[model samples]
Target: MEERVKIIEERSLSEGWFNLKEVIYDYTWFNGRVQRQSREVAKKGNYAGILLYNKEKRTVILTRQFRMPSYLNDTSDGFIVEACAGMLDDDAPEECAKREALEETGFKVKNIEKAFEAYTSPGTLSELAHLYVGAYEDDMKVSKGGGADEDEDIEVLEISFTQALEMIKTGEIKDAKTIMLLQYAQINELLN
Candidate 1:
């Protein structure tokens, strides 16, 4: 068996709206006998969230916003097309999803359903995403989307099930989370 690097020390690199940490890994994996005895060790985190669906309208709710990462990387839709999701700040996945939906869409979620939970980028970062679908009620749209403090310029989109599928096929919906939500809806017959 290959030896692995053991974390001996971890320091809070930064914490504010988000948290980052610096860690020390004992490089035993490299020091062990034979070059074959080596393995990588690291610390990571995940982005947990949920996806909302509206069975009554046969529509799915998505958010369109400028993504700095996508902009920098030259990815299409620097204005991203994604499911309503947010970072899980010490809360249960469903609770976080509900809070995010209300915050991002200014709409209330009813009969929220759990779709799935996944790692956005497991090999590199520890960003666990919780997927969810809630029945969307448009009659309850209150306030304008999201909070201003986060500097979030969000636009809400409501599309019929077929339209959503077309967007996905044409790569119009490029965000992974959004694609997953659409898939869940399709598989469950929440969408035609």
Candidate 2:
């Protein structure tokens, strides 16, 4: 299929936070017809996300913060409750997940299990998210995590597993990665 799509040209549109590029390409259809198409793609590095749970407590750790995109998209407030996640930076996926859990939720999680990988937004965003689920305990709390970055103002929340599921139904938890991870925990009986 590499021969089916040929990139004719790529122009950088923005290189600020992430990269945005305008690409012109030729697509050869299965019927032997070629069509030229143009699209704008956002190129950000891949990310790792983790749903921290405690089987004994039947609770999960989550984070809340303002999301500019969600605010622009008509959300009443930009704040979103989501699984702990961040760009992979230079670390491996599992390492990134563990690091993010600690940085965002104050949990130094051990016994983390790999959940799955998915493209967060394939149409425009170019980042594959590595998702995981982990067991956490009171002893895992090392600090009052609000994010390590100066730009991050994360509020950590620990809620019951059942309540988390209810939040999903109420649309209080709208982030895709968080919902997927929570559903995974429920389907797998991870908190039970």
- Candidate 1 worst ten-residue window by lDDT: 33-42
Model 1 C-alpha RMSD to native: 4.2
Which portions of model 1 show Cα errors greater than 4 Å? 1-5, 8-46, 148-150
What TM-score number comes out for model 2?
0.97
Q: What C-alpha lDDT does candidate 2 achieve relative to the native structure?
A: 0.94
Highest-TM-score candidate? 2
**Model 2 residue 189 CA deviation in Å:** 1.3
Give one digit per residue, the lDDT tens place, for model 2 in 1-192.
449999999999999878999999999999989999999999999999999998899999999999998999885489999999999989999999999998999899878889999997899999999999999989989999999999999999999999999999999999999999999999999988
Which one is best on lDDT?
A: 2
The 0-to-1 C-alpha lDDT of every candidate, in the order given, reads 0.72, 0.94
TM-score for each model: 0.77, 0.97
Structure candidate 1, residue pairs in collision: 45-126, 45-127, 46-126, 46-127, 46-128, 47-127, 47-128, 49-130, 51-132
